[model samples]
Target: MYKLNVLDKLSFIFIIIGAINWGLIGLFNLNIVGLVFSEPVNLIGRIVYILIGISGIDMVLFLFKMRKSFKE
Candidate 1:
């Protein structure tokens, strides 16, 4: 298992935020990111979406695989 540390904490926080954003979209049919990012038709918003999606993919992968960087 991975040792808990600052980076771990920050990643978990981002995962939480990503989860909440998806929940809002599914339940309320709302897009907090779209509203916040505004002009999704442009470049910056696309980059933001890509980053969020990547983070989500990583979190999902981590859930099934216990991190093994922790040493004896």
Candidate 2:
């Protein structure tokens, strides 16, 4: 089993949120972030988007690190 630290857990949470948002958009044409934060293109919404992007990058790095560890 793999152990995840705080940062990994946070990234996973953000990623899951992003995925759900996308699913809503695809299935219902709804934008949850936009609804919660007002216009999805606005400042707060943009900040949330940026955080999600950073979380995705973190997850990618985590995957690489895990792959390397498993090979050792």
Candidate 3:
């Protein structure tokens, strides 16, 4: 079995949060992050979004690595 390191675990958590936020947005037209950082130009919200995006990319890479591990 493949064990996740610290960065992998953090990336997974962020990705899950991003997915939930998207679900809420689609279902109820709500944005949890925006509500939490309620500013017209919130730097922190932007940073959160950027981190989520990076986490998504990290997950894709992680998935590929896992796939390769399974095939070997």
Stretches off by above 4 angstroms in model 3 are: none
* Model 1 lDDT tens row, 1-72: 565566456567767776887899999988777777784535766766676677677666665555434332
Residue runs of model 1 more than 4 Å from their true location after superposition: 4-7, 39-41, 60-72
lDDT for predicted candidate 1 compared with the true structure: 0.68
For residues 1-72, write the lDDT of model 2, one tens digit per residue: 468999999999999999999999999999999999997479999999998999999999999989988988
Best by lDDT: 2
- Candidate 1 vs. true structure, TM-score: 0.60
Evaluated at residue 36, the lDDT of candidate 1 is 79
Worst 10 residues of 3 by lDDT: 32-41
Q: Local distance difference test, per candidate?
A: 0.68, 0.93, 0.91
TM-score of each: 0.60, 0.89, 0.91
